[model samples]
Target chain A: MKRRLFLASSIAAALAGCSPIGTALNDNAGFHHALGLEGSLDAALMENLPGLAREYSIADISKNFPVDSLPTPTSVTYDRLLAHDFQSYTLAVVGAVERPLSLSLAQLQRMPQQTQITRHDCVEGWSAIGAWTGVPLRRILQFARPHRDARYAIFRCMDRDDQGTPYYESLDMAQAYQAQTLLALRLNGEAIRPDHGAPVRLRVPTQLGYKSAKWVREIQIVGSFAHLYGGKGGYWEDQGYEWYAGI
Target chain B: MQRLVYRYALLTRLAHWFGAIAVAVLISSGLQIFNAAPYLDAADRSTPTRRVLSIDSPADGIGRTTIFGHSFTTTGFLGWGSDGNGGEGARAFPGWLTIPAYQDLADGRRWHFFFAWIASLAWLSWLVSSAVKGNLAEMILRPSDLHKLWPMQAYYLRLRRDPPPHGSYNPLQKAAYTFVLLVLAPLILLTGLALSPGIDAIAHPLTMIFGGRQFARLWHFVGMLLFVGFVCVHIFQVLTQGFFNQMRSMISGWYRLREHESVGP
Candidate 1:
């Protein structure tokens, strides 16, 4: 009897935690979406469908179906990413820098640290709080010492939308300069999974969680965010989510 | 000699006492719920609400009391009767942390929830034992309970307590407790789990079961209505029942019956 009680209690607790961080973070919005008042799934599926059919030409049905249109909740695996292997992962801190050089993941880890328990606010509206740890973004920018012209920190990721739209997000240089900003390498006391931007992601508190882009491949210290796709600088922005999902 | 016959069983007594304590804490924390909704409390919380929460609690140095939803111990210094209903600007918890807490309202709500699981388990165990030994009515209900529910409602509405030995529990009392345990508690748990965001794969199915978060939220509100109804009915019953006799049964597990024998064979 006691054993049954214990099992039931533990299972309930486990069920409560079933939401993985990504989907879990968006639960509030997910709930609304489930009710048809909001829809992340439909948005995701429809967002990718057109390019999906185009990518899987009748000619290359096998390759394109596997890559572009197979699923709704599929993990964005690292092998498909050009810099999936952290050993080979390289990030070029360029632009206003006095010294522009490519560095490996190990080299980046050797830099200074910043940790914050920030909320990851998805456009869908649920949020999750996790402690993020990484090098202070401002310290890196200070090293870069942007010319007076520099205004934005353009982030490019290893993954991209099918239209060859690279997953990129930008922080206003001033926001990036906040000590809390970081090239986060860990989440909730653990190294990140490839699906969650294995080598590096941005951790910025205050802004909605999605701004903490994962799979960071490049950090270009630039004067303008003009050239980024849709001129909004991120993957979901091209998909019609608001540019700033604060709160 | 006035001897006491056993009424509430030992385990049940334990469960009841714990459940009472839990409710007390929840009601205390519930101040946070009201404070969260800023439009409600118009006046400041520092001053007591003489209008609604005029707690006629005995002067301290006795036991415990709740005024304005804050706890007052026998010691007077700790009691800060900040009425959550009277003012809006003052907060129950810091603002930024509060909403995110609701975002995971299912999380800490789990603390409240798990105890409910224990409460249910404890109740069921007690109930099964009572049913097996044929002591169910003594513990759960009695023939007198029928008239008890709506009985004092009339007296309370009119202000008279002529017919006193009105039985174990009023129909209003029976229904209120039953609904909170059977309906509101379960609805709160299910809807809470549904709001869990799709963490558990089963959470997705729960969304489907409840029709979605908005629908679950609606169901939760319905359960809250049942609770509010029960509350109104419960307070009315309390007023109708002689406060001392009924309260003694609740607090000390012994009701001092005027009659020489127990009702019902």
Candidate 2:
């Protein structure tokens, strides 16, 4: 009877130790907010404050950077803007901000710019290094003067899927204000090509490539992403990817 | 008369089963992750190779796995293939062998990370407990063990009729377990961390040690293969030595000693 009791307790202990299993099951059910919260906790505990992704030297840049194909915007407005080489392109900044602004590409170029050589890690198990020049996302957010309640910066893209759902993504306030996060305009000392999310794309060096939305049109600051499309978070997050894809 | 003796400690038994379950789950879920991006390429796929050992066709970018001058089109099985949905897809390892049993990269990552955390923590705890209990001393290789290993190997090869004089473990067993505990386990954990971009942000040195994240990924895959090899040999040994007796020791901490064997102090 003693042996039986020991065995029972051991099994119970083993089962109880597997708390992450519950989180894993929750993630599968499209309620990955719990995992996101866990990730945030881990970041706080394990990472240094204002965590900086590893930067590479100019020599480390790949000769042929692998580019994932970004869908060209099929919208008539996008076509008209593209015809004039995006001269009329004005990035609309709105929602949960004290000052709403519409800044053109030339106006954004006048802002303070940062250039850094960093590796872009793709979710498909590939990585490439490239030198990027862009305005810091934090600088833009500061200019917009986000309201105190604004916790997330939602990126609305010009491109849409077959179902006409616009490609969109969001970053938590902490990530949005990261030093390495940029609204990259140039790659390899040249304007980004159509295949590389031309005009303007997000450069979140610390996160996976998918987190960096391409062909950006508007920036929407929100208190929470609870009522956003599909309500999970980003476009891919709605399609089952984790919103906190820091890994 | 059969004699029953205490073989494993309670902690050892618990850790052993816990590790076994963790590894099984890790390997299956890991395969699912691998299926998302399976190829290991040092150069662009378009780069032309010397025709001598290359079975790659320029028309189709698929490369074949070569062994001992024999080449096989392994793309269908190993690196990239159909998603079983009547459309061409890139996936390594079949759905049946993976955790979710489908091509869901996001879900695969969740399962992998969940078990990885459990396995790594359990490993660290086991290491500490073993060190405190002097289990490491018993497991570590000694000069005397080197002499015993030859005869043990000879016995397994059927050149010798008698087993070597044994303590808690034979020399070969000690060496294998020690390598797994000290070498492979730590390397696997480090490479796993190296593969994570978030971890790299905080611990860049760790990622650099493995020559960057993609290289770390390649090494992680190789490590998984080695672990699978180790498991196969371990199970084979258990079956050959005394399946019931060996399993009983791990499960219940009591082993029925063989007729010729003597219990250790």
Candidate 3:
């Protein structure tokens, strides 16, 4: 009986860790795991593939059929959400919200906040530097008042691929409230631009770019991820994108 | 009685050949780009398999070709192509044509980038034309085909050996190819273009697709990893099934089953 109790306690801890607090460490974990198995296998091999060395082109983009946007200009990098025109935008917390707030850009900027200088890793094979400033997602969660049963937060965006379907993303609620997690309004000390989830974007710095859905227009807290578009939470999920975009 | 069915058209043949050459070059050179890896198995030199390449010969050839201060030179022998060209001939200078330019990645990059452009263009046109006429879509699996994938997957997992339902593509094959043609391929191209320094001035949209250069690199590498994973699985499937029939179908575009062959077994 005592042994069973210990096992039960440990299992509870594991489940709790799956929450936002646990998510902080586990988020963006994909990058650490996603950089490719070849890196540690050989350093000399990198010299041969010219296509991957410095730049890929439109022709290259067309070839991959799916890829990310260009690098953000250095000039516009920023520190806080309200510093730019973020106030002009609105944060729509929909889905299972008791009160789906269509918050304007200014409302988010005025909220209690946090700033983090974390690595934003991408699956495309590189990493970059940026200082993000935004309202703690926990603060927004309180405002959204997810019901006692919400299980996930699906991020819907204005961006679309060649197919014209709206791009969508999601995260388990456990990762939604990590202390470092934020709905960022500023990057590198400037207002977030349209290209980088202007107004507000989820900054699960521990996760991959795909996890950090850009140009987020709505936040939907849900009951379960299964059966969401394509039976996965994210837009790319339908097309075989990895669901746990940690790292 | 017997009429020749053009499985692969002339243009497609050209595309396939060039695509083969280009993809081969990209994958081969791609291993070189992953120099961050020290060894594959962490075993002795005898176990010889590079992390990315999976085969370990031609270290000398690869090592010799290094770049410093905008100059490309042969410092020593880095024998990468040895296994490719055959062990004996690889040791020999069968196709040893070295450029005497400075060994900047830019130099090797010229070939990779240009060839990548060519291959992508060819692939895109082929996909579009095929899609417009419904040929490509027909080849790919629909929801129904996906339902049939269980048996094929079972065959793959060693549950059964009844050859998968004969069609333009098995479910996994269609799914993999669709991703390659759609997701993985585009991911690589976008990241590739984003990484290009010179190409930006010519109306590049790397920043738009990804947030920035560093971000682009992160995404590009991930794409390559997926492709690598795909390549590994693809090779395994081909080997496990039958290389001759599978390879011929891809190359010739027509899969010939024996006269008495049926769907199952």
Candidate 4:
């Protein structure tokens, strides 16, 4: 009986090795600090290098580009806008800017356009390459004349997730103003599809796919994300994803 | 009579345990990350939603793992298992095999990258210290040891009864350790960096060297399997030779050499 009990306990202990003990360990402040270290390093490295994320050729485009499982926006306002083929859509630029503007989709399309084929890296360890055409975010930010103190550009989308949380993402000013950062109007030479963040989406080729939020409705320039929903900057960020997703 | 000797340095023992823990955490958390997109595809071409290897959980509650178009029901393990919350769920690896024992991709990534940093640093420190202490030279497979590899295997397999007097590490042990320390470690690190989009941005050539990011991921997974194989063999050897003596050497830098074993270096 004694030997049997010892064997049973040993097996239990071995099985417990796969438990959520690591999650509890992560609650410590030191682990939090260590977790942030790599993100800071990534941001610093990008700042120093400022190299372009690899751009693929037309032939390199993914044939069946995987779409994230984002549900179609079905709110009354979204349905109304969708019924009109997004012709009535306007992107509102607000907060910490010299001039807050609500620019129409036509106005955005009329602006000088930049096009590039770049790889889209999903956080889920998959990647796809596609061509995107849109105005550089820098031009729009310049037009708005963001305040020098404004540190982040928060993109609020029209979609609400399963938890009733509005889909949103943010980028630091440096990443926001990257040459490849775009408020994309087209994908693969065609108008964006509803399933793929139609009308307009943020295309950040350098960061993870989540950072490139789809169906972007508003761009809010802010000094800090402390006052945002969940006080964590973005929808996924609020759910514990790293805010700096350059990785 | 059994002889007690300082078989491992304090630094060596500490690094071994530290790296061992870090690697275990890394592998488990990595599987958690892998569960997020449980599919593998070609490196160059765009995958058509499905890939070479895909794990699917149909709405009918059957968990299927498909490899090369071959399907297998791997329920309660690979494709579906208990969620550690008294409910059944679909996930690539079982709950007990993952770090948090739950499905949280973000937290899994956190655990993975955190320990990845630790493991890399530990490996580098050990490499440098061992080299400085001339332990690295001692680990290399000498020409004389090459011929004895088969004999060592034969002895371990019980084909030969009497154990021959050997150095701190047997020929097979030296070869395996050298392969792991030199080849597998560097392969895993390089492939790991190749998986990072941030690193790819700054070091495109590095990713390309591995034949693209997808290939790099495949290589990284392969390297992990090799490491796991090495660990299994290592433990088996320890258990067979003398478990307590091996554990004591690792824990306290002192090992009780068997009577037939030659004196320690």
Residue A2's lDDT in candidate 4: 67
Model 3: lDDT equals 0.54
RMSD of 1: 20.9
- Predicted complex 4: CAPRI docking category: medium
Q: What tens digits encode model 3's per-residue C-alpha lDDT throughout B1-265?
A: 3222336555666666676556655543344333222122211111222122222233454422322212233322342432222242221111122210112122223344445766787787777777776768756757777776788889777899775666656677778888887778878886766543323223236544564544454456567678768866765565545556656766776555645453311
Report lDDT (CA) for all predictions: 0.49, 0.75, 0.54, 0.83
Q: Candidate 1: how close is chain B to the reference, as a TM-score?
A: 0.52
Considering TM-score, where higher is better, how would the candidates rank from best to worst? 4, 2, 3, 1
Q: Which candidate wins on DockQ?
A: 4
Off by over 4 Å in 1: A1-247, B1-3, B27-170, B198-200, B203-205, B228-236, B259-265
Q: DockQ order of candidates, best first?
A: 4, 2, 1, 3
Please give, for residues B126-186, the per-residue lDDT of candidate 4 as tens digits: 8999899888887878898888888888887889985454676778878998899988999
Clashing pairs in 2: none
User: Candidate 3 - CAPRI tier?
Assistant: incorrect
Off by over 4 Å in 3: A1-67, A70-88, B1-265
Provide the lDDT at B198 for model 2.
78
For every model shown, the clashing-pair count is 18, 0, 109, 0
Find the candidate with the highest lDDT and give its number. 4
- The 10-residue segment with the lowest total lDDT in model 3 chain A: A57-66
